[model samples]
Every structure is written in structure tokens, then in C-alpha cells.
Target: MKKAAMTIALLIAVVATAGIVTGGFSYDPAAAQAAARIKVYSAEMRNYFMSDEIVKSKEEWRKILTQEQYHVLREKGTERAFTGKYATTHDHGIYRCAGCGLDLFRSEDKFESGTGWPSFTQPIAKENVKTEVDRSFFST
Candidate 1:
């Protein structure tokens, strides 16, 4: 059964990679692969997607970040409990700051805190990690 499942998964992967369209949904291999690979282990590139210390005006940031992103990363807004896409994700890769692409957390350090938040016990780098008191509506 395992072998058969693996074979089916392999076939699906090939079909998806070939950019198949099924039931009004089109598969983009490049985009799918890119999304899957966003979890980086270490920084190896000089300039990727954006440069380090990306300083932009509020207007520019409003133009760049999505509504949810602008609210969360910019205003330090918190999503409702159990509503974030990554809250329960268990992927093995780096968790980067959506606003600055700063490497934040590692997959191995993720744990279920019963608070419906993505909690990490270990940050990959101390230099990149800083803590500030969250004085938001949900600050504890």
C-alpha cells in the first residue's frame, strides 16, 4: 500500500509539474515549487526578493504589503485565535518575517503551546532576533 501510494504521489507530482489543468484549476509548477521552497535553511544569497534593511515609506509599505500583512507585521496586529495559515503548519524549514524576510524561527523549535500561536523555542540566529513588549489588544 505504501509503495502504491508513493507511485500515485509521484505521478501526481509529474502531472502537476507539467502544468495540468483540472476542473478550472491550473497548476503552475514554478509557482508551486517556489512557495514550497520559501522555507530556507540559511542565508546564502546577497540580494533575494529584497535587500537587507528594506526601508520604505508607509505609503510604499501600504502599496506593497497585503491587508493582513500590513496589519500584522506593520501594526503588530494579531489574527484571531486559530486563524493564521501558519499557526499549525509543521513544515521543516525556516520561518522568515513576512515583512522583512528576516530569518526568525526553525521548524525543530516549533511547539504546540495551546494558545493557537506559532511558538518557537529556538531562533536560528540571536543577532536577528529581538524582543519587544507587545502592547496590542491581545498582549499578555
Candidate 2:
């Protein structure tokens, strides 16, 4: 199952990369801004499509999230390996996005990938997370 999932993900990455190279997957910031209320899931909601999406400005996010969280979520900074609170956690509950309280992964899907990060085999639902190609300075 893991192999199949990884294969599918790789195939998607390949296709997306091709589209990007061919100028077919250009990003539009306006489109992202327009998609304010995206689908989300929360443990309390118990429904993937019913949870309300939380959209906040950078200042608002800075006020709410911790400094580290602000750096990671807003500035696209990553936490150091093995330093995350949930990296080695064995708790029984749904994992959520730090920026928003959207349920992302089920506890059952969590696995030890030995990468010193909380890894999940899959998300709770396909719509819970949005995947896009990274076009940052470090991206190749």
C-alpha cells in the first residue's frame, strides 16, 4: 500500500512538473486569494466538507500563532528535525494544520519514517490538504 501510494504521488509530481515546464501550470495569486473558503476538516466537526475555513492576514496570523509558527507557516520556514512536539508523539487523535485548525491526518495513518518528522501515510481525506509544486528560491 505504501509503495502504491508513493508511486501515485510520484506520478502526480512528474505530471505537475511537466505541466510547469510546459507553461501549463502557471500560478495565479489572485486565484489563491479568491479561494478564501476552502474545504477543511476538524475532529469536532466530524465532517470533512463541513468545517469552516479560516483565512487571516499575515498580521493577524502573526498575532495568533507563535513566533516559530509564524516563521514556519507564513515565511515557509521548516522546523529543525526532531524538534517538533509531535515528531515522536504517539497520541491518539487527528493531526491538524498549525496555521489553521483543519484536520489533516488520522492517527492510524501516522508512521515512523525515521526522518525525525511526523509522517503520515495519507491524509484523512483528499481535500483536506492542497499540494502544489514549490517554486521558491531553493526549489530546483
Candidate 3:
């Protein structure tokens, strides 16, 4: 009985160590492929942003953009639902961050979803905007 218990404990330790070394569990090739695509897309988008010619300081931004825009773009505030001019505009220009002027969504991607906020099927690039998990019930 003592030997059996020792053997079981040793096997458990071995299995746990193997799991840590081999990345916890079975691998999914599809997940790996998706992750790779996301990585490439992210890199490309970042490069695109870095290549753009616009440059401005925080002070310059305050002068150029409205208070709300400044708060949304610079301070990461979410614009109030149904309040952005771009939510209704159908112009052919790129939607930029009004505060930093960083090109965000393309005009072509904008669609009227009637959700009281501007909606887009996709952003121009992943690097153009930053997203965080909004846990506040009112945020969504």
C-alpha cells in the first residue's frame, strides 16, 4: 500500500512537470495559424502608423481638437453614445483620432448600425486604436 501511494504521487508530479514543459495541454493548429495571422497584421499596422507623416505635441493637440476629442483620444475616454459627428457623416475621408489625429477607421468601413454610436465592421488597422476590456456595465 505504501509503495502504491508513492508511485501515484510520483506519477502525478511527472505529469504536472510535463504539462508545464510542454505548454499545458494539446495544441491546436488552427489556433496557432490564427495567432500568427494576428501577429502579422498587428506588425503591419504598427509599421503603417509609424510611417505616417503627422506629428504633434499634447499642447498642439489641445489647440487643434475640441475638449471632448482631446479627452477621448488623449485621455482614452469613450465618446458618449450618439454624440459624435462622424457617427452620421458619410464623407470619404479617414476617421482620425480628433485629439492625436491618428488615422483610425476608414470611411468605407463605417456603417449605420443605429446603435447610437459610430460603428465599423473593421478598423483601418489594429495599430490605429487601442482597446481595453471595459468592465463597467454602463460602458457597453
If scored against the real structure, what TM-score would every candidate get?
Answer: 0.59, 0.65, 0.51
Instruction: List where candidate 1 sits over 4 angstroms from the true fold.
Output: 1-52, 135-140
Q: For candidate 3, what is the TM-score?
A: 0.51
Best by lDDT: 2
Better of 2 and 3 by lDDT: 2
Model 1 RMSD in Å is 19.5
Off by over 4 Å in 2: 1-34, 43-45, 50-53, 135-140
What is the per-residue lDDT of model 2 for residues 41-127, given as tens digits with 9 covering 90 to 100?
A: 656767756444576888899898999999987887889999999999999998887887777898899999999989999988788
Give the residue spans of candidate 3 off by over 4 A: 1-64, 138-140
Please, what is the whole-model Cα lDDT of each candidate in the order they appear? 0.74, 0.82, 0.71
Model 3 is weakest, by summed lDDT over 10 consecutive residues, at 36-45
Q: Rank the candidates by TM-score, best first.
A: 2, 1, 3
In model 2, residue pairs whose N, Cα or C atoms come closer than 3 Å (at least 3 residues apart or on different chains), thus clashing, are none
Clashes by residue pair, model 3:
none
**What is the overall TM-score of model 2 with all chains considered together?**
0.65
Per-structure clash totals for the candidates: 0, 0, 0
